[model samples]
Target: MTINNVSLSHHGGEEASGLLEELCDAYADAYGVEPGEEKTVAFRRRAEKQFSRPGFALVTARDGGRLVGFTFGYTLPAGDTHWWGGVQPEPTADFLQETGSRTWVLSEIEVRRAWQGRGTGRALHDAVLGARGEERATLATGPDAAAQPVYESWGWRRVGRIPGDEGDYYSAYDLFVLELPVSW
Candidate 1:
């Protein structure tokens, strides 16, 4: 279906819970996986936890009430071992010292397969990141993921890679970070 008009809306973490299932389903479908699969299930669980973080933000794109795409993330606390520890080569001391206030981790951004290449993903991504108050944003993307180019085009630079954990879907992912434009 052609999306002639995609309307985007921003919602707080709690307010976005209602659409979680739909968002997860869209994510699975976009990647050609079933929602009940192990990786998808894990992703859903992870998303649920992320939604509870302080400053969590979600942006959904809809076409006449039908969900087309969505993106969400939360601020990363500095010194957080969970994320920084996973990097293959240790990050610079400055990068490791995340007090949890400087960076925003853009956890997920997905669009329905039917909606791919229509700019819906970009719209949703920009809507979420543009609204963020953090100084920089980070995300991990597999080298082969289609969205990698889109991210690069938007100024996300390759910084590093995280060696994939055993049983994870992808073997490794190139990490990307973007210094957000300071808004006056």
Candidate 2:
């Protein structure tokens, strides 16, 4: 696939209506779940509402006018460190509280199965973080050691992992951080 042809857009509010479902479906499929099992209404609702918040931003990847991938995040408030729901499990309040004012918590990054390994993920990451210089950006991913290499290559470091819910059969996750210089 020609990655250069993919366009990125910042979607917000009701504009995020169907995207939560799309992202969740892509994520669930990547973990080998059945179609029906992937459609969690509650998850979708929570994700949609979260993305609609003021500090949140969602970048969508489009190829030939079709949505292929997306990534979203927002500034972490001072009082609350542990934000729950959406694609990420609830983090500890202390884990998030130490971040500076520029702290960013990435909520999700997902590409359709057909579009994997095509640089869409990198494009989304770059588009999202490129504008914020010197801010600390963090994300938590389920135990997929393979993803660690990719993140490290992009300047992120392994920090820690919050315990996964017993309901999460995939694996425990790892938290990663990239302390960017305040040059931007």
Candidate 3:
């Protein structure tokens, strides 16, 4: 699909697995992750796990076939207590009842440095969510202006925070949630 002159493509996790190297390249470019570093390897491993989950999907933005940005995620199953374990304020049981259809967890989103501020990220975000059937979505990013302000501008509200985990890529981050369209 073409959006604002950038070509957008959607893929199931299986197919997306083949593009991990390229996806990582885009990630490294956007975040300054040194090539062949431990963090890069860890990110790849995480991406693999994400791809293997049920309801997984990926969307990529390309400019003449070079990745400019991408977004991907999967739906959470009911009772994923581990996932909710990090939320600062524990959620109520009613809010935790997912039934596997209530939430889509956006695992990764990035726009290459060259493409930043030109709407490429927004385009990729909209393309992915626009294709999702879930009633709502959530994502986590660092709790700072440099990290989450853009998400806030896009309508996500910080519902809570996740304490940093013990890992190279782990850090305390604010959790944001957004409701998807629901026509009565």
Which model scores highest in TM-score? 3
List the pairs of residues colliding in candidate 3.
none
lDDT of 1 by residue, 43-136 (tens): 8888889888977998888887878788898888655556665786667788777766688889888888898988898878777888877778
The lDDT values for all models are 0.81, 0.69, 0.83
Instruction: Give candidate 2 misplaced runs (Cα > 4 Å).
Output: 1-3, 24-35, 39-46, 83-100, 166-171, 181-184
My TM-score estimates for the predictions, one after another, are 0.88, 0.74, 0.92
Task: Tell me the TM-score of model 1.
Answer: 0.88
- What does the lDDT read for residue 117 in candidate 3? 87
Runs of candidate 1 with Cα error greater than 4 angstroms are: 1-4, 86-89, 182-184
Q: List the residue pairs that clash in candidate 2.
A: 134-181, 134-182
**In candidate 3, how many Å is residue 156 off?**
0.5
- In candidate 3, which residue ranges exceed 4 Å CA deviation? 182-184
Clashes of 1: 6
Best by lDDT: 3
How many steric clashes between backbone atoms does each model show? 6, 2, 0
Candidates 1 and 2 compared: the better one by TM-score is 1
